[model samples]
Target: MIQTSPKTFRLHIGIFGRRNAGKSSILNTITGQNVSIVSDIAGTTTDPVEKPMELLPLGPVQFIDTAGMDDEGSLGLQRLERSRQVFDRTDLALLVASSNIWTEFEAKLLEEIHNRKIPVIVVLNKTDISPPDPEIVKSLREANYTVIPVSTLSGEGICELCQAIIESAPDSFVNRPVILSDLVGPGESAVLVVPIDKEAPKGRLILPQVQSIRDLLDNECISIVTGLSNLPQILSRSGFQPKLVVTDSQAFKEVAQITPPLVPITSFSILFARFQGDLQTMALGALTIDNLKPGDRVLIAEACSHHPVEDDIGTVKIPRWLTKKIGGSPQFTFTRGHDIPDDLSGFKLVIHCGACMWNRRTMLSRIERCLRAAVPITNYGLAIAHSLGILERSLSPFPGLLNTLKTTRSV
Candidate 1:
């Protein structure tokens, strides 16, 4: 029997360094297992390796061992690119240097890590052979970088490294937000409206729905799940009033019609818009749709790759709605899963999915990328509501966001 947490729920720690710097060895020691193929040969770990384990006190963590930044040739460049991609999603970064060597490569890595504003710990490995340079250590310390010397051969300093990681973890991870529980109090009831459509998974709910139900249960809130057809009956039944109602965004219109005005109604995507990324930025991005021209390029990003049906949401439905709103179809570019383009300059606006399959770190990373490129990015739920002319009503749960929408509209 295996007990494993969802990858998205774990803290992502990326181990990065030049080739043969014992990056994989550090991962092996920390995980107590050979999570990566450690070899004296350079560039042996061609791709990023992931290890999910429970790091005590820090809770669940996913360690990613990436290829060396100093890799050579065409293949090496690709590997380096992949490693950089991993860095974009890392919550905490471990920069491994061995045998007292700290060069421009390490400095550049430090610059990149610091630019991302990610917490980092510098590990000086192979201390048995040669300890870290005293001058280099002093300089790094003066710059406020935590330096820990460890030897994989002797298992030295591994404990300190783990402790450093726990201390360096973002405060958001240590105190996670309750998915749906915060909305409905303990003993209160929540009604989930799930539409069983062609896109629905066979015999299983999507990740967001499952997680929401589990969160309600964990928060001691009662949850009642119903399909779109049965939602009216469940809501109108005698002597039962749910504290809140959450529906899939695709069924927002029907659910809104069926749900009464007094009940607070929201969508799973809306919840995730706040949970995984910056809700305020996404809400503002929703207003950008009015500025989209017919030929303006729009990027539609989805976190999970799935086969598209005739009426797919990302490619078909959303595009259809946007065309009607903008008076013509914008150049729709679709990117599935984690392959968010590095260059967002060509796009006028980006409409992203709820990102239930992604962690908060990854979602924020994408949002940061969009911000850097000066591209407006909004999630599916907000985009849908804005196009449907009910964005203000749908965002009623968050009064601040509603005010933001009003201010932006007035401007």
Candidate 2:
């Protein structure tokens, strides 16, 4: 990884507080730059501002300065909502309070952070004006929170705040889960079938494909890359037998046809289903496709926003296949990028993309969001496999997921 990495690959630390609580100042101090505008007027920083930098021992980390949690008015509500959404991806939170002031807003923010199970460090800013109340500090300490008093004007206690964040970051951030190493051992061979279509980038593979190849190489395995047209010949005439064969989800049907039944074959999306999010839950959620009613609503979500071409997968193909299979034209809603709605009230099911652009924490957060809304969420690969009648075969790599689906659903 380079010094300037993607935001999804960085550890996200969110600075949250009420209006004029020196949240922006703390961010500027920590980053040693004016990343966010500092002003005396309340609600100066409306939307969340992000600053990405390299933090020692923790690698890349992005600090997010959010709007006041106590903003009031029509537009204020929207800003507040956006601020709260930051919790979805936050690895660590800094609750900024100043003048020894702690109100319902602060308490509510702390409760929300604790509810999300994110580690938090309470920051008492502007201690030069009014020092932290001993009683309040004691109460916070009793709750097992590390409270630090800092004056951004004088740059005091910034080191302590950074140290707290470094210590509190989750271990999973450093030690990430393997994409396919656990399945393919050292010295083993795996063939990757990448279909070069118009949708494919010129002279380059997609992120999932690149990451899969890199993972195999990192595990000391032999990776063979070939296009879909040559997959049959490769499988038939190659002197080497691969431990697994991975392909793009869109070509699952074709790959399944050519590959032998004994060879364990899967898609890039299926690999990500285990890498980024819950595999079994998503596999079980795929069962809901069979139970869709006439007027059911399905949400199609993608992580990256790209120009839509004719017969787009998320917009056109999946919906057409689903509607034809269900014998009804179900209402479909589309969302792309980071604009995931917090309220998933009326949606019966959510079909999400592979989320290769996002980190494990963000993907899990989206899954939890759907679960909280009492909605079943499945990814593109699982849904595609289920639609093509190869759901069981595609999920064969995972030992118990197919059996779980069998016991739960009639299929």
Best by lDDT: 1
Report the C-alpha lDDT of model 2 over 264-290, residue by residue, as the tens digit: 888899888888899988898888998
lDDT of 1 by residue, 1-411 (tens): 986787778999999999999999999999999989989998889899989989988899999999999998999999989999997679999999985899998999999999989899999999999877999999999999999999999998999999999999988888888777888989999999889998898999998999999999998999999999999889899988898889888888887888888887888998898889988999999899989989999999999888999899999999988899889989989999888777899999999998887779999989989998999999998898888777876787777778878988998
| Every candidate's lDDT | 0.90, 0.88
TM-score of 2: 0.94
Instruction: Say what the RMSD of model 1 is.
Output: 1.7
Pairs that collide in candidate 1 are none
For every model shown, what is its TM-score relative to the native structure? 0.95, 0.94
User: In candidate 1, where is summed lDDT lowest over 10 consecutive residues?
Assistant: 389-398
Q: Candidate 1: count the clashes.
A: 0
